[model samples]
Target chain A: MSSNLILLVSLLAGLLLGFFTKPAANRARLANRLLMATILVLIFMMGARLGLMPDLGERILAYGRAAIVITISALIFSIIAVRILVWLFMRKRGGEL
Target chain B: MMLLAIISCLLLGLGAAYIGLMPPEVAVFVNEAPFYCLCAMLFIVGYGMGQDKNTLRGLFKENAFVFLVPVGTIIGTLVGGLLAGLILPLGIRESMAVAGGFGWYTYSAVYLAEMHSADLGAIAFLSNVSREMLAIILIPAVVRFFGAYPAVSICGATSMDVTLPLLAHYAGSKIGAAAFLHGAVLSFVTPLLLPLLIGF
Candidate 1:
């Protein structure tokens, strides 16, 4: 299945469970702890993936110039676009949100 | 504390793997591990959504604005990268394709590798990875100054997973559904548009 599909299914399952359970405070806190543990494993795996990739040093040396420029530019412009779009959206809605 | 754990785990994982301390089976496990973790994360995300009707209501009322987030991200990312391209040796389309990853490095980098060259692929990988890191670090500041919507957009595809916890913490539950939808739409469109853009 697509990663997207997996995401939706998992989310739906969680929703059903959450809605049905009406989790108590302790249960909710436990869920948060579990989520944190999951997040740590995920981050570690991401790092492992990065570590396993080939030619990191060479690639960085070669692409470092363009990578830095493109990364920064993409962040700036995407933020700008979202800002402008949200601004226009709020204006159309008739006030600040 | 959460951020510290994330960064440290990442560093620790990198160190162990780089030093060949991670067992070979552990390498195989890594491939499958994150996918499952992602599923759990999304599940919790959904649970949070279900737990709050107000948040869902807010997302529904802002449906039009929700539509705009991805639109802005696409236009903004492309325009930003294209402008940045002026200084680099890459073609305009190449720049767009690279930034088009929206912090999804693996697929875009692989696609660019096949469509263009390994060099462009490497660039895509590096830039997208850097983009994710930057978004993760700056999201709180972005939300504080610019508002949550833009902060979410800065996360791009990562809003769905890696950077998601940040979105929830800083943006509050009201912004949850919208950010998830925004990330989902971008994640869907990226693979389709990126290759097409590279061809153009």
Candidate 2:
């Protein structure tokens, strides 16, 4: 099977399990523990990759610029969009103030 | 399920990165950053679901007007992005920046950088990721302090995922559902608009 197919199957299986599990027990906690373990392993692998970088300074600069522009734009857009949305919808709903 | 999803994504990302199908850096990002993020997100989502399953049902029934909120958010986001492009001193790459702002920040930045030789891939990544993060943090505040509409607007493309829960939590599930719908509708629209506005 293709990796995509395998991934999809896994996802479906997980969803089914999550769906069937009663919310009362510590099932969620168990799932969280599993997720945490996965994350730690992934993080270690990522750090290894980062350590392979030859020029950390240049990479940081490049990534930094990208990060700054994206961050600012995202922040500005989010704030403004939320505000405008509230203004238009709230009034229509006859919301006070 | 969420854990499995994260693992699957990690594996896919790792394979893609290792195979040189995508930038190694991106693979690293997928591995390092999203693991913690997704873990926290999954736990929170599960906890929230456990705590408020009943409240969610009740809220949906109570506030039908909440449906209008997400519509406002989408419109607001589009306008905000356009305005940012116009006002910001982003130079020739402003369109790319706008595309990033529209929420395909990683793809937008990387594509534009490669095409234009602008080397702004990091900026694109940060811009888009920041939008997602900001939406996560601000959606609830925006909903409670301003209103649901504004909160959704601020979320941009993240309304479907990161901001959806917060919207449901604060604005009511009806509004959250509306936000998801609005986000879905906007996702397709964003791809088309990103290219037009950013020239990529």
Candidate 3:
């Protein structure tokens, strides 16, 4: 099966399971534990996979200047854009400044 | 919680690889296992969303204003990228391809490498990696100063995965769902935009 289909099926299965389960505090706690465990494993695996890639030290050193500039700029612009939207939203609501 | 775990594991794995502790066969598993793990994570995300009525309701109840997060993020990243490009020796197309990763470094870097230069690919990888690290550190500050939506938007594609749990925790399920949506949209476009923009 296709990866997309696999992703969709997994999501749908989870949704169905969640929909049917009773919303007890214990159940929520279990789910939280399960989520945390899965995330830990997933991230660990992600790190391992990333580690298999080419020399990161050289990559960082080679591209550090461009990378830093680009990343910081993208971050700044994204924040500024959201800040502007928030201001516009507040203005529409006649929020007290 | 996540920072310590993620950083430790990442360093441990890299250290292990560097020291030649792991076998070559481990490389095969490393390539495929992450994909399965990602699917499981997505499933968990779906389950959480399914259980949360408020998240579902917020997703459906949104109007045109709701689009601001995704739209603003894309415009902001591209604008920032274009401006940042002015400083680089690289062309605008190359810069966009690098920034277009939107924090999904592996896919965009590989794609760019195949379609463009190894240098551009390396730049894309480093750019996206730095973006993720910065986003993790910045999300809380963004939440405190700007608000939840802004916090989520700045992280881009990472909002769907690496940053999702944090977003859900600090920002609540409502913003988590929005961040997921925003990330999904960006993730879908990163590949398309990288090549298309570069072609121009």
Candidate 4:
């Protein structure tokens, strides 16, 4: 089948399944379980196709430097922002330090 | 349910690996990890929605402070991105800034990797994902030990998804509502601001 056709069918199926499933505990659990199962199967298939395992270590090493820089910068920025905002708010409201 | 979500994600990773063995044409959707990850996210969202109507209703209120947190976070993200761009090497700066803003490396990392190259993309992914995981684990203690505004800021871009729920669960429910609103708005704004600031 064509990509468009597949997409259309999947979309319809998803909607139909979603609509038919009542939001009760038993039904929701069943739906979640099915979805989880499908996700697992899909992931395994994708990994096999891509040969993810062998390249994993190399990918990590290659990307390590850049990742560290980004993570540290983002973390520091977030922390400072939170601190300054809290300080300003506290001062405005005359709250304790 | 949260445990179920984690298991589902793991299952998804395994499934993606299995699907990888198939011919590309035969497994279009499953071949794309991001697309499948998104599907997982959507299901998680739906499941959360299914469980609680009150979640939506509680989002709005007088004491919520919805506007304040976003304003603070966005300002923080933009300034932070600008600083990172200036100081960090040029290669992965834009992706990093964007990840910093939204706190989800997966989307930006994948996009940057595909558009630019794998090296930068992987960096973005790892960094952003780390930020998200850290926020999830730390935000509650930060809030309880410090206060709401600080927790909101500390979690920064990740406040919406990972931290918002954590805050709601641990902090007062009212604070959680405010955090959710702040986080959601920031998620949208971060992408727009990233390019302008970081030149991505």
Give the lDDT of residue A51 in candidate 1: 64
Query: Candidate 2: where is the Cα deviation over 4 Å?
Result: A1-56, A62-66, A85-92, B1-89, B92-101, B104-118
In what order do the candidates fall by DockQ, top score first?
1, 3, 4, 2
Per residue, candidate 2 scores C-alpha lDDT tens digits across A51-75 of 3445645765655564554455545
Candidate achieving higher lDDT, 2 or 3: 3
Give per-residue lDDT, candidate 3, residue B190.
Answer: 68
Q: Give the least accurate 10-residue stretch of model 1 chain B, judged by summed lDDT.
A: B106-115
Alpha carbon lDDT of each predicted model: 0.75, 0.50, 0.70, 0.54
Q: Which of 1 and 3 is ahead in lDDT?
A: 1
Candidate 4 lDDT, A1-97, residue by residue in tens: 2422333344345544554555577766676676556544443433343334446656566456655555566556666676666676656764322
In order of appearance, the predictions have TM-scores of 0.63, 0.51, 0.63, 0.61
Superposed Cα deviation of residue B112, candidate 3 (Å):
1.0
DockQ per candidate, 2 decimals = 0.44, 0.20, 0.39, 0.24
Pull out the clashing pairs in model 3.
Answer: none
Kindly state the number of residue pairs that clash in model 2: 12
Q: Candidate 1, residues B100-131: lDDT per residue as tens digits?
A: 99987745654565457657866886788788
Candidate 4, residue B23: how far the Cα is off, in Å = 4.2
lDDT of 4 at A95: 32
Name model 4 segments beyond 4 Å from true: A1-56, A94-97, B1-60, B85-93, B144-146, B156-161, B190-200
- Global lDDT of model 4: 0.54
Candidate 1 lDDT at B191 equals 55
